[model samples]
Target: MARPFRRYSAGARWYDVLSGERWVYRAGRVAGIGLMDLQAGDVVLDLGCGTGLNFPLLRRAVGEAGHIVGVDRSADMLAVARARARREGWSNVTFVEADAAELDVDGLRARIGAATGRATADAVLTTYALSVMRDGAAEAWRRAVALVRPGGILAVVDMQPPTGRWRILAPLARLACALGGADIHARPWRLVARDAAPGSVREAAVRGGHIVAAVGRSPGEVAPTARS
Candidate 1:
């Protein structure tokens, strides 16, 4: 299926607005920070890093010697990220334009190797992006997993179905997303949770029970992996 997020290049400004007002985005950033467990010289990947909202956070965690790559499908979004990087003068960061589902893992490793002489990531993060993938959420998860070297981590934070009887609230959330020019219905949070890989799932609620943040690891330290 054609994903709604692929249309996001045109809606970059609208997304920025939604992210600013949404508590989910805030919680996701916090959760991503905790899950990343960054250290000096660590290499990190921020998949679907729209407008580099979390770049500053990642930059702080990684420090001067660390490296961060922010990947997004939208050139428009990447433009914003680039502008931010330049404005902030963050020399440790690089932004790339690419689809998450189709990202070339080896090519990415090669680039990182050239930059840092390594083929592994200390952390990989995807915030509010996986749930909207056109490929099934599982495929997205698998692709994300493939990016990490053994024992690395993948962390994802996005809007999810409300826990318990709050299911009726989804419509209101959808309406709010629509007002911001986003297609919330295109990303089904509950479906992503249901399809998540076992043995590595950790989840939490945000926005007074309106959104969720989930983290999955590749059977190792808290560094972070996944799709929806």
Candidate 2:
């Protein structure tokens, strides 16, 4: 976490500009959130939220009545995220500055309950954040899932080497992932498929499969129709 946070600190101010939000990474989150199919008044957790790039899309889905809990370890990145919420006059958004790997689940639950009157979120999302967690990725993912209620949504959007004709851009993709402290080979979205209710998984591949998004209901629910 510190390694990625180190790079994030130096680039936090310029992240939205240089992070390829316009032409690249944003599409992954869009696909992932779309698969989540969030409803208005839902309480969603944005794990490793960074500079709140996902805020606009999430706000649109959940609307003003819903709550967003943005979690990240980097103070610099959280600073930018806070600025975004403030600038947008988003009163429903709260932030927790903590490493997802070392998060105190009970403390987080209490906080979320206090903020939104619910201990568990309706859905939890992590976009382009897990692979960068390196050794702590799985632990972080576990803690994230614990913060959601049974049958809540789980979504992951992460990177991998491009496929098909986009293979020609693999080197550039690797370079981008390296600079961002991500492991392009991680394929973290697999966790969604693993934990999803049977036949409930929804998936999409964007940016020629370099960016893959997977979403599904967490355990404890009857399976729903699948989509891909």
Candidate 3:
């Protein structure tokens, strides 16, 4: 079934503000740099790309020669992304309106590589957005895995349930969501971590909480193990 796009459309304007506060803290730039190992001439897909907040960072990584395809279910969000692309004169970036769960992976692959004259992306980045997806994230991840060619990477960042005593911060997590127009307590990261292939999931502690960031190739390809 097609996912509801209205949920994100209504919140598009507020998405960036909420994400900026939660993820863009001290050392976030550094972490983003590390997570997005972009290369010149590489093609990238920014999934659940809200307001295209990650565009600048992605542009820097991919360089002028590469391209970024920002996909989101919200037309409002894509509008912001398109406007930003125009304002920045980034002709290489394109925004598409599509449900994350039902994205046209083959079509996108053709678009990204066709424009760049390449066969596959160097990386795919999804940040902070997947945790809130209603369902079908597993299929989404599987599609992501299939979209990239051998040796490419999938970088994901999302909140995790607090561990041990830090679980007390559950209220803060809810506040972060409330401020951002999201569920007060969504924990899709746990599901991803559980289903993720062993040695392919890494956890990064952001502020007082943790976010999972994983990188790997297609299921059969040998890729770096999850960093301990």
TM-scores of the candidates are: 0.79, 0.95, 0.79
Against the true structure, candidate 3 reaches a TM-score of 0.79
The candidate, 2 or 3, that scores higher on TM-score is 2
Clashing pairs for model 3 are: 199-226
Q: What's the distance in Å from true for residue 5, model 1?
A: 3.6
Top TM-score model? 2
Best by lDDT: 2
Give the per-residue lDDT digits (tens) of candidate 1, residues 110-187.
777777767666667777676566454556556656656655656766664455577777777666554434445444
Please give, for residues 171-221, the per-residue lDDT of candidate 2 as tens digits.
999999889998999999899888878888989999998999999898874
Q: Name the runs in model 2 displaced over 4 angstroms.
A: 222-228
Taking the tens digit of each residue's C-alpha lDDT, what string does model 3 give over 1-228?
A: 233345556766775664554443323334644655667767777877778777887888778987888878778988888888999999998677777788888887777667776656666677666665646666676676566655566676666555567779767666665444444245554543554456655555554554445554434453532210
Query: What is the C-alpha local distance difference test score of candidate 3?
Result: 0.64
Candidate 2 clash figure, as a count: 0
